[model samples]
Structure formats: structure tokens, C-alpha cells
Target: MLSSWFRVIRVKFLLASVIAVCLGLAINWWQNQTIDLVYAGLTFVGVIALHASVDLLNDYWDFKRGIDTKTKRTKFSGGTGVLPEGLLQPNEVYRAGLIFLIIGSSVGGYFIFEKGITIAVILAFAIISIYFYSTKIVNSGLGEIFVAIKGSMIVLGTFFVQTSHITMEPIFGGIVVGVLSSLVLFVNSFPDFDADKAGGRKTLVIMLGKKKASNAVWIFPIIVYGIIVSGIVLHVLPILSLITLFT
Candidate 1:
């Protein structure tokens, strides 16, 4: 069952979330030398839990709304694992998501209690964005901006909780992660274009059509890489090790 769940997550989506976690950890580690291991571990777990909650809730919501149909989702194929295929009911998926969300929020609340007040703002936005993404408010094309903010907030919030200070470095790194992760959403939007349109989900791809959505997918990576290279070349960011290549 554990292995099946792992497979359900899918490598691409898992890797993307892993990358976001790495970006958060990288920023925190870079800025702090005496960070607590337990705190860091909790943050890591929080990130993963939140990722799972988002996926599971999305599956549950999509299924409920009839957005995930038999054609769009296969028995072993779409919207996580068992949920869409009728192997699991909506209540089960909803319960799993709630459990993970509680765990994540517990860790996050701990960090907030230890950290300063700045984290409250980020947490507020994070919770709101997560809720609204698939809800009525997000179906009007505003979810893209929320997603971008979500990506950026991970790094900023991570740094704030760990270091208890804010700097421009994490801000820069946040933008990079925000834009790259946004690209992932942009591409994911492509195949779901017609469905999204049909469902009245006015997401970016739904509004732009296939051609412009494809253009966005290609353009985002270019712009992100350009910013990364520009920062390194202009000495805005100090030369680190080979890890910089991936960033």
C-alpha cells in the first residue's frame, strides 16, 4: 500500500515538490549556520505533507465536481491513485487530506510560535491560497498569481522561521522558484485546457488557449534561466558550488 501510494504521487509531481522543498531548505541553510535539526526536519515534513494535501484535495474536489471523468482519468492513471478510479471514496480521500493538513499545520504553527510575527502574514496567504485554488474564487484566472505567491512564500517563510530575519537573498531565490514552479503549472494546464474551459475554470491556459499556453511554457523557462544566469554574472549572487547549476 505504501509503495502504491508512492507510485500514485508520480515522479514528475514528486520531483517538482521536492525541488520546491530543496529551494526552501537551500535558502534556510544558506542563511543560518546554527539551525536546529528538529526544526529543519519539521519544515521538510511540512512541505511534503502540504504537497500531499494539495494533491489529495485536488483529486477529491475534481472528482466531486465531475471534472475528473473516465476519459480524462484511467483506473491506474489520473488524479493521484485510487480516488478517481472508484477504488477509494471521496470521504477517504478527504480524510487523508485532512490528516496530512493537520500535521502540516501543526508544524507550521510551531514554527510560527517560535519565530517572529512576520510569518503570520505568509501563513495567512498560504492557507488562503491553498483553499481558494480549486474553489470558486480561483476558477476566475486568479489562481496563477496565487500559485506564484505560494512558491515564493515557501522560501521566504522557511528563511523567516529558521533565521528569524528577512533578506534580499531569499527574495531573489523566491522569485526563481516561484517562476519555475509557475512554469510547471503552465504546462500542466495545457492538456487540461478543454476540461478546464468546460468546467468554467478560467485558469491561465483556459484563457490563453493552447498556442499561447505552449508559448508560456517555453518562455517561462527561458526567463527563469535568464534571471539565474544574470544574477550570477552580475555578481548579485556569490558563486557557490555546482548546486548553483540546478538553481
Candidate 2:
């Protein structure tokens, strides 16, 4: 029973959560230990919860939007539309999503209350921004940029949470991981573009023409990573902190 329930938690999505935690670990390491195990673990759980909500919310919204209609069977996802799969009830999915969302929000609220404005303000913006990024509001119109931005925030938030200040290190690391993360979002969209367009999903790809979108799929990451590596080489990231590369 436990193993069966475990399937509901997507491994790939969990790996992404691991990456976020690793980012926090890296930042904590960079700052020479401003965060200890308890705080870091809690914060990592918060990050995982955010990623979980994103997966669940995205699936629920897509199901509602007809993007994952009968013709569309499965998506590369954490939720995987289990309701559609007949493996779980709709209400069950909702409950799971809500549970994760509440836990995630509670953790974030703790950080806000304890750490004050810097992390709190940014997290508030991130929540609002990402929520809209999946729904009709910001999701369709400014898809690429929004995805890129969320990717960047993993690094940004990690840096600030540890040091309580923003610095060039996070900026550079943000761009690197940000572009990689954005690339993941961009490419994953490709498999779904047809269904999305069929379902009247007006994503950036649908709006700008898939041709441009395809170019962007390639161009955006390269350019962003190029800048990041260059910054590292030019000593913009501080040579002493080069240990960041391995972590």
C-alpha cells in the first residue's frame, strides 16, 4: 500500500526538488554556513512543496483547460492526471494538491515571519507570479520569460535565505541554473504544443509562431549559460568561491 501510494509522487519531479535542495545546500556552503541542518532541511521541504504544488496545479488546470483531453493520454508530469488515468479520484487529487499547497505555504510563511522582508517579499512575488504563469493570466502571454524567471528564483531565493542579502554569486548561478531549468520547461512544452493548440491554449509558442518558439528553445539557454560561464571566467563570481561549480 505504501509503495503503491509512492507512485503518485513522480520521481522526476522529486529529482527537481532534490536539485532545489541542492541549490540551497550550495548556497549555504557558499556563505560558510549561515544555515544549519534543521533550517536547511525545512527550507528544502518548502522548496519541494512548491514544486509539488506546481506539478499538481499545472495538471489540474490543464485537465480543466482541455489540454489533457481524451485525445491526450499522458503528460510528462508529477500529477500525471491520475484522475484521468482512473487510478485516483478527482477529489483525491484535489486533496493531495491542497495538502501540499498548505504545507508549502505554511513553511514559506514561517520564513517570512522569521527572516523578515527580503525573502518574504520575493516569495510573495514568486507565488503570485507562478500562479498566474500556469493559469490564463501570465501563463499564456509571457510563457518563456516567466518560466525563465521562476528558474532564476531558485538560485536567487537560496542565496538570500542563507546570506540575507543578494550578491553577484547568486546572480551568476541564477542565470546558469535558470537557463537550464527554463530549457526543461521549454522543451517539455514541445510535446504538448500540438495538444495545447488543439485545445485553444494560447501559449507563447502558439502566439509567436512555433518557428520562433523553436529558435527560442535553442537560443535562450545558450545565451544565458554563455553569459554565466563568462562571468565565472572573468572573475565576476569571485575566484575564491569557484567551489560552487562542483556543488
The lDDT leader among the candidates is 1
lDDT per residue, candidate 2, 85-179, as tens digits?
66755566556766777787788888788788877776786677645555764346666576566666776776666667777767776666666
For 1-247, candidate 1 gives per-residue lDDT tens digits of 5654554434356555567666666766765645667776787787677777777777777777766763254333335546656667688777877787777777788877888567767766766666556766448787667677777788777777777888877777777788877776766666666666666678787788787777767677676777677767766555762255685
Q: Once superposed on the true structure, which residue ranges of model 2 sit more than 4 Å away at CA?
A: 1-9, 33-35, 70-81, 137-139, 238-247
In model 1, the clashing pairs are none
Whole-model lDDT for model 1 versus the true structure? 0.69
Cα error, residue 5 of model 2, in Å, equals 5.7
Q: List the residue pairs that clash in candidate 2.
A: none
Model 1, position 131: C-alpha lDDT score = 58
List ranges where model 1 is wrong by over 4 Å.
1-12, 70-78, 240-247
How much lDDT does each candidate structure score?
0.69, 0.65
Model 1 poorest 10 in a row by lDDT: 70-79
State the displacement of the C-alpha of residue 74, model 2, in Å, after optimal TM-score superposition.
6.5
